[model samples]
Target: MDTILNLGLNDQTVQVLAEATGNERFALDCYRRFIQMYGDIVLNVEFNKFEDALERNKRRFRVEYDHELQPEHLKKIIDEYKEIIKSSTGSEFPQEPMEQLRKAVMAVFESWNNPRAQVYRRVNKIPDDLGTGVNIQTMVFGNTGDNSGTGVAFTRDPATGENVIFGEYLINAQGEDVVAGIRTPLPISKLQEEMPEAYDQFQKTCTLLEKHYRDLQDIEFTIEQGKLYLLQTRSGKRTAAAAVKIAVDMVKESLISKEEAILRVDPDQLNQVLHKRLDTKVKFNVLAKGLPASPGAASGYVVFDANEAERCGQNGDKVILVRMETTPDDIHGLVMAQGVLTSRGGMTSHAAVVARGMGKPCVCGCEALNIDYKAKKMTVGDSEIKQGDLITMDGGTGQVILGKVPVISPEMSEELQLLLQWSDEIRRLGVFTNADAPADAKRAREFGA
Candidate 1:
C-alpha cells in the first residue's frame, strides 16, 4: 500500500503547493504526479508501468533526478502514465481537477479495506465499519530544493520525555521520505546548522503548539525556501517514563490543572515502568546495538518468523521475534513475543510503534545484524545465531546480547513518586493492590498504593 498522509487544507489549496516554486508550474506538476499515483493506487494500474515510463523519460532527457525533469518532460511522462493507466484499467485518467479530487477522496474511503489497513485495524482493535474520512486541502511541496524539506518533530524527547525538541528531517525530500524510512534523515537539530532561520521559526511554533495544546505535540512541518509551514500537530506519543515526567512537569509548570495531569497518565502504562532492566554493573557480551525503540529487558529463544513466534509463545515458550522489518501482518507475532528485534526500520516504523504501544521491548534498525530468513539464522559480525538460540536484549540501551544476561527489578524514581502522589490525590477511584507478602506490600506502598 502507498504511504498516505492526512493533510488539513483550508481555502488556499492550490496556493500552498505553488507557493514554493511560483505560478501554476509546480501545482500543475503536482497534479500530474497525483494523477499517476491515483491511477496506480485507486485504479489498480501497475505502479511499475508508470515508473518505467518515468524512468524512460528521465533517460531520454538525460536527467539524473526526478526533480530535475523539465515541464515538457513531466507533461510527456504524465501523458504516457495516463495511457498506461487506460490500457491497464480500461478507464480514462480524470483530467478535470474536480474529477481527480473526487476519485482521490473515494480512493481513501476504499483503502480502509486494503489488506494492510485491515490487518492494522484488527490488530489495534479499531472498528472495521468506521470508514476513513477524506480531508482535501492544499498541498505543500517539501522537495522543491535544498531550502525546502519535510520533517516530524516532538515537543519533548519521545524516548525519555526530556524537555527538548526531538525529531528527524531531510532536505529536499517529501514527508514519506522521512516516515517511510526510505532515507536515513538527519537529526532535527541539524536544521539549526543548515537552516538557522527556519529552525528558529520551527522552535517558536513548537513552543506555541505545546502551550496551546497543553501537551507534548508531535508536529509535521515543511520548509519552502526557508519559510516554515506547519502541516499538522497532535499529542505526541512518549514512553512510560516520559509520560510520567511530562505529566508531573506540566502540573508544576501549571500548564494543566492537577486533576488533568493525573488523568493524563494511563494506569496500564505504570506496568511499563516496572519492567525488568539490565544491570549496568554486570558486564556481558553485546552482539549488536540499535535504536532503543522501546524500554525494558527481555530474554527469549529467537524466532525469525512471526507465526513461529506465536506458536512458541502459545506453547508457553518465550520467544523474541526478529525480522528485517515488520508490517501490520506481524502484529500477531509481536503480541506474542517477549521482545522484537528488527534490522531495517526507524524508531517510528511499524515494529517500533506497535512494540511501544504494547509495552514490549524492541530494538530496531540494527544494521549490524544480517538476517537470512530462509536459513532461519542471523549473523552479527563473526557470531551466527540460529533459530531457538537463547538471546537477551536491553531495549533501554538498544543492546542485543548473545545470551541471557543478569537483570534487576526496576525501581520507581522520584518523578514517578510525585506523579503517582498527584494522581492519588485527584483520581476518584481508590488504588489497591493484591500484594500478599510484606516486601510486595512495601513496594506497593512506596508506589502510593
Candidate 2:
C-alpha cells in the first residue's frame, strides 16, 4: 500500500494549519514530510537526497530523531527541501493542491507496475493483470506534537504466535516513519506510559477487532491531539510457526472450530517451521552480531543492492541482501535473498517484518559492520568482506559468521505436530508416497504417509 500523508499542505495552507492548530512546529513538520514523500513518489526525486538534507539539519541542530527538531530547524529543512525538489525535478514543489492530488493519485495507480509490486505479485502468484486502487481521504496529522503518534500492531505476536499485543510506534511521527525503518520505534507497551488514554482506547479496539474478525488482526492507528483513530484493520500476517500456534490456540479458546483452524494454516508455510538451524557443535568465526529479528539459519554470498540481489538470484546464486535498511521498494530483493542483514533499523523494521512474513532469516541493527555500497565491501575494524564473500547468518542468534557454517534440520514444534494431527483427522483424502529406498519409506511412514 502506497501512502502519501499531509496531502493538502502547500505554502498557503501550511500557515493556515499553523494558525488553526496554534502549533507552527507541527505544521512545518507536515510540510517537510509532504515534500519528502511528494518529491520521492510523485516528482521522482531521489529519497536519499531529502534524507541527506534532513541528516544535515539533524547534525546542525544536534538532534537524533526528526521529532527532536524545533520549528525554526524544520523551517530551514522545508526551504532546503523545496530547493532540492527544484534542483532535481527542474520545477518547484507543486503549490497547487488539486494538481498535487491528481498527480498523487496517478502515482499510486502507476505504482501497481513498479518493480517491487511486480516482484511481490510474482512471488505470491498474483496475476499480473490485476491492478491497484487509490483511496483519497482527509489527512490527519500524527506529527502534531508529543500527544500525537502513529503505529502498526498485531493482536497476537506475528513472530512467536504468543497471545499478546505486539507492535511499535513513534511519537510525533507519520505512519511511514514507523514502517520505513528510518527511525527505530518504541514498543507498543510503552504507549501506556506515554499516552494512557490512547493506549487504553487502542487495547479495547484491538479486542473488538479480534473478536469480530475471529482471527488475529493487523491494525494501523493514529493519535492526534491525544484522540485515537483506527486507520485500518485486516488479518495479520504471521510466520508459519505463529500460524499453527494461533490456530491451535483459537480452537482451544472456542473462538474457532478444529476444522476451521486446520483450514487457517497454509500447508506451504509449514516448511518455515521445519527450517534449518546452525549446527551448535561447529566452530565458526563471528564477523559481527546484531538483533535477532527472525528465527532460522542461512548462508549465501553477500550482495549490497536489491537489484543485484535479484539478478544474482535469477542467475542461480544464493545471496544475502545487505542494506543500511530496507523499504517497501526493496520487496524484490527481500524475496530473492536467502537472508537479510542491516546495519541500521530495529526488530520491527520493514526488513525484519517482511522477512518474517516470508519465513526468511534476518539480522538487523548490526552496527559493528560498516557497509560501503559504492566500494562493494563491508568492514569491521581492519577486516574487509568484499561482495560475493561466503557468509553465514543465524537469525535465531543474530550472529554473522565469517564463512559458511553447517546447519541441522529442526524438529517440529509441539503445536505444529498437534495441528498436523488435527489436519490428518479432518482430511478426507488418503495420503500415499512413492519411496525408492527403505530410508525414504521409513521417513514417509513417519510423516503419516
Output the number of the TM-score-best candidate.
Answer: 2
**Candidate 2 clashing pairs, residues 3+ apart or interchain:** none
Q: What are the lDDT scores of the predictions, listed in order?
A: 0.78, 0.89
* Candidate 1 C-alpha lDDT tens digits along 113-138: 87767766776579988777666656
Local error of candidate 1 at residue 185 (angstroms): 1.7
Q: For residues 210-271, could you state the per-residue lDDT of candidate 2 as single tens digits?
A: 98999989898889989998888989878788899999999999999999998898878976
Candidate 1 wrongly placed segments (more than 4 Å): 1-100, 114-130, 303-317, 327-333, 373-376, 426-438
TM-score of each: 0.77, 0.93
Worst 10 residues of 2 by lDDT: 177-186
TM-score of 2: 0.93
